[model samples]
Target: MSKVFAKRLFDGESWLTNQQVTLSGNVIESIMTVEVPSADAQSVDVLAPGFIDVHVNGGGGALFNHTPTLAALQRMVEVHAQYGTVAMMPTLISDDYEIMSQAHQTVCQALTENMGGILGLHYEGPYLNPVRKGVHNESKLRKPTEGKLADLLDVCRLSKLMVTLAPEQVPEDFIEWLTAEGAIVCIGHSAATYDQARQAVESGAKGFTHLFNAMTPLVSREPGVVGAALQTDKPTWCGLIADGHHVHPATMRVAIAAKGCEHMLLVTDAIQSVGSDEKEMAFLGKKVLRSNGRVTTEDGTLAGSDLDMATAVRNTVSLIGRTEAEALQMASLRPAEFLGIDKEFGRIKVGYRGSLVALTDDFFVEATWIDGQKVWG
Candidate 1:
């Protein structure tokens, strides 16, 4: 058993002052108010549930698409943990069948080995519309074949699988079939009309990837995919980048106003540049550069991002005018709830996992603990 005392604690739902949280093995055992923290109780200025990222391409100079190995997974996890991310879904942007299969196998092996901080795999494309396939190799994009669909379903059965696709590019029943087999379907990189987007949601798409980027906008008459995402009342979650570049502050404000804090979440959509000193990298035969906190291709297409989860929370608070609690919830509980692991992973309650992050007053990461074991400081 171990204990951590926090001067300020956000226990997933509300804030409390001067509390001690106890842990046994990997689960939180108890929490109580404390006037004087014990000498042995590891203390922190701020404690909250660890940030959970549902979309991450790479970090620590290890691009999952470039390596797709266990070593790469370890590196990504190590770097993100420093930024307060205790768990993440390593995302593979639109790749060929062979690469996708390799990524799936790699994640399965990681899970079997009980690799810390790996939730599952996020297959971000290959079944996307080329018209809006931001930074994705158009040549790699294709309609889903029967064999490919079956293989993807196998991935779902093995672990938590999130498949992002364009609604118009796949069959009408594709989302339903994938969801039936336990895959989390998300709409992204699509130019689907509002009706098409709504149909995809009704069919089983649970979330929208990187809302307002790489998607049809909410026009006055068309009310495209963006409109569908905003107007839907079907428990669907929308992931905002919150980096001040992928989306405008005013636009993010409007999205929050429309979707409510409960149904909105923050995702870094981060790439290899994050947590690394490298300023340039090659992506799908294109030269990618990181400048001023943004990653863009040579032709000026926004690739991924240089943002991290901690900075995302800060941006949400400072740029979007949200409270610290609201920003933390968007970074933690909302993503956990979207991934269907809220009960175990997103809170500091008695029965929840002892995965938490300690932050400074400005929301910078001071330390991180996963399963009650300190991983970064």
Candidate 2:
């Protein structure tokens, strides 16, 4: 067993001070108020549940699409861990069947090895709509076939799979079928109408990817995908890229107000430039550049992002005017709930996993722990 002393701690739901958290193996063993600081306890300024990123394309100079290998995935985990991301779903943008199969096999191997910080695979799609294929290769976009669907089902069987597609572009029963097979279906990169979005949710689409960007906007007359995401009464999650480039602060504020913070989570939608010194990288045979906190193609198409989870949590506070605890929850707890791993990974309770992060006063990550083992500092 191990013990760490937290000067201030956010235990998922509320904040507490001067607490000692004990861990046994990979799980939190106990937590108690510390009337007096123990000299043996490892001290931290601020500790909270580790951030869970559902959408990550690359980091540490590795792009999952470019190099669908175990080494590349490990590099990503190392880079994001410095930013307090204890778990992530490595995302592959629209790609061919061969590359998709390769990526899937790589993730399976990682899972089999019990690699730290690798939660699953997020196939962000070959099944997306071509119209809103931002940075995704248009040539790779296609309708899902029986063979592809079968492969995806196998992926769900092996690990947690999150598939993103356009509701209107897919068959009426595609979302239902995938969800039934244990895949978390999400809507993105489409011009689906409000009704279409609603129907997709009713049919088992659990979330919206990158909430506003690459999706139909909310208009006065016709509520588009954004409208449906905000107005849906079901327990659906919406991923907001709090990077400031993908969404305006005011717009994000309104969306959070409408959807409520419990249903609103943050995603980086990050690419290779994140957590690396590289200012330029290749994306689907095209050159992409990172500058002034934004990553974009030469033609001014917004690619993914250079954002990290720590900065995302910081932005939720500074940009969106949310409390620090709320911002931390969006980064950790809410995403865990969205992925249906909340009971084990989202909190600092005694029975939960000992995945946690400590941050400085500026919200920069000081240390990160995944399953009771310190991974970064």
Candidate 3:
């Protein structure tokens, strides 16, 4: 068994002290919180579950929009690993049907070769409200036609397909249909009214993608998509970008108050610009202007985020008024649970996968492991 020891550890719920965890292959075989490190253990600091980012556009100067080759996948995965992101769903923005199809094939190929970190494909566009589409090219937005989506996922042979659609545009029945096919339907890039958004949720829209940004706002009479997403009784996981830019600090508080931390998943929603020190770059077929850790266009619409998974953890904690343990949950265990992957990925408990990250006191991931294998930088 391979073992890791940490001075502090997050056990998926709360912070604990003096953790010594042993793993064999992918599963954690044993866990003990004791004073001394195990004889067979490699010691680290603040060991936590490896982060699971449900939305990542690109990293390491490569983007899914530009070219989604397997090599590009490897690059992003490596860069994200440095920040403790272990498993991630490669996100592709709204694009032509042909480009999306190729992305699906890319996911299938990644899966076939045991590219373990590639969870699935996230289609963030093509069925969205053009009125609320942010960086998504409005020209490529399409109405949901009968069987078009199923055909796309099938062609790509994708097991998990997360689609973010504007409830204002797509029919309610499509939400039911997509959910029935095991495709996670998320509401995002939308101008969906309250009733429309609620109907989508009722029809099996399980999540809200990058909530509060590019979505309808809460109103007195209208309530809007943001309002619908904040309803706690609803079983939807509200995905937050948490960059301190996409949603304001006060608004972030409201989201946390409305939806409990468990009901929220933190995602970078990062485009190709994340993790790159490169000053000049082109993204989404246009120039990306970056200054002081902010990535945006000259017009000031957020292109994506320079914030990686680790920084996301820090930023979320600052906004939520919660402990580091709680914020980390949004980045790790909670997201894994939202994806129904908690059994294997979210914790350092027995029988769980050894997807762990060692973070500094400031929450920077120093090293990452997927299963028991180190994802070296």
TM-score of candidate 3 versus the correct structure, residues matched by position:
0.96
Residue-level lDDT for 187 in candidate 3: 93
**What does candidate 3's lDDT look like per residue over 160-263, in tens digits?**
67888887787757888877777888999888789888999888888998888888899889899989999987788988887777788788887787788888
User: How do the predictions measure up, each by TM-score?
Assistant: 0.98, 0.98, 0.96
- Give candidate 2 regions above 4 Å deviation: none
Write down the worst ten-residue block by lDDT for model 2. 146-155
lDDT of 3 at 172: 53
Which lDDT value does model 3 have at 241? 80
Candidate 2, residues 1-377, lDDT tens digits: the string is: 77888889999999999999988889999999987766777898899999999999999889999999999999999999999999999999999898988999999888988888888999898888888888888999999896666874566766689999999988888888888889999999988999999999899998899999898899999899999899757889999999999999999999998888998888998898988888888887999999999999999999999999999999999999999989999999999999989998878999999999999878899999998998898
In candidate 1, what are the lDDT values of residues 251-295, reduced to their tens digit? 999999998998898899899898888888887778899999999
lDDT of each: 0.91, 0.90, 0.83
Clash tally, candidates in order: 0, 0, 0
Error of 1 at 19 (Å): 0.8
Query: Measured by C-alpha RMSD in angstroms, how accurate is candidate 2?
Result: 1.1
